[model samples]
Target: MKYQPIDSQLFIKNRKNFASKMKSNSLAVFNSNDIYPISADSTMPFQQHRDIFYLSGVDQEESVLVIFPDCPKANHREILFLKETNDHIAVWEGEKLTKEAALKTSGIKTVYWLKDMEKIMFELMTQCDTVYINTNEHYRANVETETREDRFTKWLKERYPAHQVAKSNPILQRLRSVKDPIEIDLMQKACNITEKGIRRLLNFIKPGIWEYEIEAELMHEFLRNRSKGFAYTPIVASGNNANVLHYIQNNQQCQAGELILLDVGAEYANYSSDLTRTIPVSGKYSERQKAVYNAVNRVKNEATKMLVPGTLWADYHVEVGKLMTSELLGLGLLDKADVQNENPDWPAYKKYFMHGTSHHIGLDTHDYGILTEPMQANMVFTVEPGIYIPDEGFGIRLEDDVVIQENGEPFNLMGSIPIEADEIEDIMNS
Candidate 1:
């Protein structure tokens, strides 16, 4: 990992909290993600399963974490199973964590090699009456590929058919939604890295520059700052491409008067920061562009204030839709009559500003949060509002990661990054 070692206390507390919520005589298991293959002899980069990392801080493949607070044997209560490390393996690949290193990485003292997993698990299964299985239940999830966690769940269920099965996703959704002080600091680090990437582009972006070139600049900054790179597939859409909400084909040339909607962010450790900023290709927004940009910024600012404790995620979007509708009406994109006659399912603002204004942001770009529940303090979210005008030949989006506060307004994690229309223009021109 490029990032520095995190204090093990965070993982320790996470495990304790999760264990407290588990049913008595139940054992919860979390598995590391698979190193997916791209083709023969090549593979996509390994990404540790966020659940395992959240509880154990084990950021490697072929690892397992088990939490059993009610175990008769104290040492077996919390355990880690890791791939055995050897000198030959270390010479071919990088050093895998030794038992001692695993203990330091995670706070769990009992570490076993993968070879002994079956034997240990068999003993554990006999002792525990219930098994908590981890599953992907995120609101935005549309997973088709069976994950390593899914395989483990299948195997465990087949092996221990009599054991009462319980889901760990619900508990995790609630627990991971609220941030720990340590986690908040880690996410802030990610946002800081993203800030560096954006500041670098302020001077680098110009007419005739390819969208991919801008993506490269951000990647360079993120790597130098100890970030693994983008938290999600980056969108460096220039001009009309911005109208496509998920645009990632960064091959277009940025024209002199067009706006580039940069939906990009950097990841530090395993935490994610999501940011979207629209900048002028020629280093200055035209009068019309400036008006649309400021309107989006105004919507983002107003939407962020609604992220305080007790706000429901669905209700918050409805309120944000109202703010966007007002902005669109002022921009002449929507008329008062359009809103009155608009379908309730598809608001009038949908014509210009479609996507949701905010989403939970941390570990995963679209992090885990139950939308039906009320917002809580320490929950991190992205306040992004965009205006896409295909007729006008440009799109504008402004986003920032914020922490829901106990008091008045949520704290902006990307507060240091320039967002104002004048500030962006000044930095680019200077």
Candidate 2:
């Protein structure tokens, strides 16, 4: 891991909070994500499962965490199972976590090697009446690949058919949505890294630079800042490519007058920050481009204010749609008749600004929040509003990550990054 070690107290608090919510005589288990393979000898980079990292702060693969609040044996109550590390293995593949290291990484003291997992789990199963299984139930999830969690769940169910099964996703969704002070600081670090990338691009961007070149610059900045790079697949769409909502080709040469829609962010300590900004390729927006950019920025600013305590995610988006509609009308993209005759399901603003204005942002880019529930203090969300005009040959988007406050407006995490058209232009021209 490129990032520094997180304070174990954060994970200790997270485990305590989660354990408090578990049913009596129940044990919850979380597994590290498998290292996926590409071909014969190559494999994809290992990413620890966010849930396990949240609770245990163990960032290595082939690890497991078990939380049993009512265990008869005190040492078995909280346990970690890790791949055994030896001197020979260390020489070949770098050092895996030593038992002592695992204890330091995670606050859990009872650590076991993977070779002893079956024997330990068998004993644990006999003691607990209920088992909590983790699953991906995020609102936007469309997972087709069976994950390590799924395989563990299948085996657990088949092995202990009589045990009462419970879903951990619901509890995790609620718990992970609200940020702890430590989590908020980690996310802020990620946003700070993203800010560095954006500031670098302001001076580097010029006519004839390839979109991929811009992506490279951001990657370089993120790596140097102890970030593992982009939180998601970056979008460096130039010109008409921005009209395609998820354009990531980033192969085109930037033209003098076109706008580049950069939907990019950096990750630190497994926390994610999402940001989107549109800027002129030539370092100066035309009159029409300036108008559209400001309109999108205005919509983003207004939408961020609505992310207060007690606001519903769905209701907030509806309100944001109205703000976008008003901006679109002022931009001449929508008229009174367009709104009046528009379908309720597809608002008039859909023509120019289609995507949702905000989403939960934290451990994952699209983090785990139950949208039906009311927003709460310390919950982080991204306020992104975009206007795509194919006819005008450009698209504009402005986004910022914010923390909902109990009083006043949400706190903008990316406030230090320049967003105003004049500020961006000034930095570029300087």
Candidate 3:
């Protein structure tokens, strides 16, 4: 891994919290993600399943974490089954985590090789009445391909048909939503790296530069700062291309007097930081562009304040919609008749700003948080609001990641990065 090692204490606390939530006499299992194949003898990089990474700090493939808090034997309470490292594997790949190293990395004392999983699991399953299986329950998830966890779940249920099945997604969705202090620190590091990348673009972006070139500059800054790369597919939409919400082609050449929307972020140690800044390709926004940019920034700031504890996710969006509507009226995009005759399902503001103002941000960019539940402290969210005007041939979006506090306004992680119209202009010219 390119990033620094995190203390295992965070993982220890995470496991304890998760175990406490499991049903009595239930054992929860987590599996690592598979190295996906691209073609003949070709494969994509292995990304550890975010759930397993959250519970145990294990960042390797063919690893399993079993938490049986009510196990008869104390040593069997927590066990990790890892791919056995041999001389051949060491020479071919690299050093896999040894028992001692796993202990240091995950705080799990009992470590077994992957081959012993059946025997060990059989012994443990005989004593437990219920088994917790992991599954994807994210609000935006629409997975078609079966994952490693899904395969293991099918096998587990067939092998132990008598055992009561429970879902680990419920517990993880709540726990991971409210981050620990250590997790917040890691996210801050990711955001700081994103700041460096965005600041670098201030000097590099100019007329006639290809959008992909800006992407390369950000990637270079991220790699040097110890980040693996972008948290998501970067959107370097320039000119009217920004009107497309999910535009990620990054193939257009930026022209002078046009606004380029950069929806980019840096991922440090698998923790994600989402940021979006629409800047002028000429290094200075024209009057109309500046007006729209400031309006979006204002909406982002107001939306962030609504992320405090006890706030409902759906209600928060409604409040943000109102703010955006007022801004749109002030910008002359909507009128009294538009507001009065607007559809309740899709308001007049949807014409310019259609997407939600914020989303949970942590391990995944659009991370796991139950929207129906009330907001809580330490939950990180990205406040992004945009105004797209196809007729004007430009679009503007501004975003910042914030952490909801216990008793005050949410803390802005990207506060150091320039967002003000004048400040961005000054930095670009400097």
Candidate 4:
């Protein structure tokens, strides 16, 4: 692991919070993600399932975590099932977590090898009346692959058909939405690393530089800062490429007078930080570009203030749209006729800013939080507002990660990362 070991107290508290939500006599299960295959003898990098990692801090393959607070045996209350690591595995694939090490990493005393899962779980199942199954019920989740957790769910239900089944997603959706202080610290670390990457690009970007070259610079900075790399596919769009959301084909060369839109973030210790900043390829924004850039930055700042506790997700966006609408009107992108005649479902501002203004961001770039529920303190979200103008051959977006505070406005994690047009211009020329 490139990152330092997190204090297990975070996982211990997380497990306690989760277990408290389970129905009495219910056993909850979480499985590690599979090392997906690419081709014969080749595999994608092993990524631990976020739920398991959140609960146990076991960042490895073929691991399982079970929580049964009211278990007959006290030692079985919280258990970890890991792959048995031996001398051969140590010499070949490097050493896996030892039993003693797992105890320190997870704060769970009982650890078993994968081979004993069936025998032990079957015995424990008899003592419990319900099973809490982990599922992907995230609003944006569109999974096609059968995950290891999914496979285990199918097998668990078949083997224990008599037991009542409960969904862990709902419980987790609420618990994980509210950030623990430790989790917030980790996210702050991610944002700090992201700041380093963006600062590097501000100096490195120049006319005639390929878009991929900028991506390389960001990756280099992230890796050296103990980040694995991007939280999502990075978008290093230069000039008109910025008009296309999710544009990742970073092969085009930046021109002297064009702007490059970077929608990228770094992941540190599995926590994510999302950031977007559009800057000039030639180190100076045109008069028109500066206006659009300032407008987007203003919208981003105002939208962040609305992230305070008790704000409804849907209502907050509607308010953000109003702010964007006002900006667009000032820029003449929308006229009185456009505003009055626009469809209520798709507002006039949608013409320029189509996607969402913000999303819950943490473990995943789009983290879990129920949209229907009112926002709460400690919830982290991204404040991103953009204006994409293909006709003008440039697009502007400004984004930052923020945490909703108990009082007043949300705190910007990327506050120190220069976003003002003048500041960016000064840094670029320096």
Candidate 5:
């Protein structure tokens, strides 16, 4: 792993929180993600399942975390089953976590090899009345591939059909939504890396530079700063490419007087930071571009203020819709007819800003948080709003990650990054 070792107490606390939510005598299990295959003898990089990573702080493949908080044997309360590392594996791959190392990394005392799982699980299952199975329940989830957790769930059910089964997703959805102090610090580190990348692009971007070149600059900055790379697939859309929300083909040559809409961020310690900034390709925004940019900035600023404690996610977006609507009206994009005849389901603002104004950000770019619940303090969100006007040959989006507060407005994590139109222009030219 490129990142530093996190404090094991974060995982310890996370496990305790999750175990408290489980039914009495229930055992919850989480599996590491499989190292996916590409072609003959090739495999994609292994990304530890976020849930397992959250609970155990173990970032390796073929690992399992079993939390039987009410186990008869005290040592079986929190167990880690890691893939056995041998001389062959050490020579071929690298050093996998040994028992001592796992203890240091995870703060769990009992660690066994994967070969011992069946025997140990049988004993634990005999003592427990229920089993918790992990599943993907994110609102945006559309999984096609059967995961390792899925395979284990099938096996567990076949072996212990008499035991009551429960879902770990609901518990995880709530626990992971609220950020621990250590987790917030890791996220802040990610945001700081993203800020460095944005600042680098500010000075590097100029006329005739290709969009891909700008992306290269940001990548260089991220890698030098201890980040594994982008939190999500970067969107380095220049000029009209910004109109296409998910545009990632950053192959176009940026022309002078055009704006480059950069939706890019860096990941540190597996926490994500999401940032979007639209800057002038020529190092200066034109009159109309500045107007649109400031309007989007205004919308983002206002939307962030709504992310305080007890605010409903759905209602917050609706209020943000009104803010965007008024901005569009001021920008002359929507008229009285467009407003009056707008479908209530998809408002008039959808024409310019189609996506949700904000989403939970953490381990995943779109992190796990139940939208049905009211917002809570320490929950990180990205307040991004945009004006996509293909007719005008440019689109503008501004985004910043913020943490909801108990008292007042949410605290902007990306507050140090330049967002003001004048500030961006000055940095670019200087």
Candidate 6:
């Protein structure tokens, strides 16, 4: 791992919190993500399953965690199963975690080789009446691959159909939504790294530069700061390309006097930080570009203030729509007649400003949080509002990661990164 090892106390506290929510006599399971294959003798990078990483701080493959708070034996209450390391394997693949290292990493004293999992879990399962299965239930989830957790769930069910089964995702969704202090610090670090990347681009961006070059600059900054690069696939769209919401083919040449919409973030210790900043390729925005940029910035600012505790997700977006409507009307994108004749399903502002105003962000770019539920303190969200004007040949999106506060307005984590029109202009021209 390029990032330093996280404090195991975070995992300890997470496990304790999760254990408290488990049903009586129930055991929960978590599995590490598979090292996926690309072809013979080639494999995609190993990415640890977020849930397993959340619970155990074990960032390696072929690992499992089981928690049975009701177990009679103290050691069996929390157990970690790691792939055993041998001399030949160590020589070929580098050293795996020693048992002592695993204990330090996870704060679990009981460690067993992967070979012993079935025998030990069978004994523990007999003692527990219910089992908790992990699943991907994030609102944006569109998984097609049968994950490691899925295979384990199938095996567990087939082996013990008589046991009552429960979903762990619901419990995790609620818990992970509320950030731990350490998790917040890690997220802050990721945001800080993103800020470095953005600031570097502010000086480097110029006419005729390739969009991919900007992506490379950001990746360079992130890696030097001990990050594993972007939290998600970066979008370095310029001009008309920015109109495409998920544009990631950063192969276009940034023409002079065109706007570049950079939607990117750095990932530190597997925690994500999302940021979007639209700027001029030539370091100076045209009058129309500046107008659209300010409008989107205004919407982002107002929308961020609405992310207070108890704020409903649907209602918040509705309020943001109203805010955008007023801005679009001011910009003459929508006149009185346009507003009057617009359908309720898709408002007049939809032509200029589309996409949700915000989304939960953390370990995953779109992290787990129940949308229907009210916003709470310590919950991090991305306030991103954009105006895509294809006819005008420019798009503007302003996004900032913010933490909902217990009182007053939510705190912007990227607050000091410079988003205002004048501020961005000064930085680029300086």
Report every candidate's CA lDDT. Answer: 0.93, 0.94, 0.94, 0.94, 0.92, 0.93
Q: Relative to the unseen true structure, what is the C-alpha lDDT of residue 284 in candidate 5, on a scale of 0 to 100? A: 81
- Cα displacement (angstroms), candidate 4, residue 329, comes to 0.8
lDDT tens string, model 2, 1-430? 8999888999999999999999999999999999999999899988889999999999999999999999999999999999999999999999999888888988899999988999999999999999999989887889999999999999999999999999899999999999998999999999999999999999899999999999999999999999999999999999999999999899999999999999999999999999998989999999999999999989888888888999998898999999999999998999999999999999889999888888898899999899999999999999999999999899888899999999999999999999999999999999
Q: Candidate 2: deviation at residue 405, Å?
A: 0.9
Residue 120, model 4: lDDT of: 99
**Cα RMSD (Å) between model 6 and the true structure?**
0.9
Model 1: how large is the Cα RMSD against the reference? 0.8
**Per-prediction count of colliding residue pairs?**
0, 0, 0, 0, 0, 0
Residues 1-430, candidate 4, lDDT per residue (tens digit)? 8999999999999999999888999899999999999999999988789999999999999999999999999999999999999999999999999999999999999999999999999999999999999999999989999999989999998988999999999998998989999999999999999999999998899989999999999999999999999989999999999999989999999999999999999999999999999989999999999999999989998888889889998999999999999999999999999999999999999999999988998898999889999999999999999998999998888999999999998889889999999999999999
TM-score of each: 0.99, 0.99, 0.99, 0.99, 0.99, 0.99
Model 5 has a clash total of 0
Question: What is the clash tally of candidate 3?
Answer: 0
lDDT of 6 by residue, 1-430 (tens): 8898899999999999999999999999999999999999899988899999999999999999999999999989999999999999899999898799999999999999999999998999999999999989887788999998899999999999999999999999999999987998999999999999999999999999999999999999999999989999999999899999999999999999899999999999999999999988888888888887888888888899999999999999999999999999989888999999999999989998779989998888899899999999999999999999899888899999999989998888898898988888999999
Query: Which TM-score value belongs to model 1?
Result: 0.99
Cα error of candidate 6 at position 380, Å: 0.4
Candidate 6 TM-score versus the reference: 0.99
Report lDDT (Cα) of residue 319, candidate 5. 98
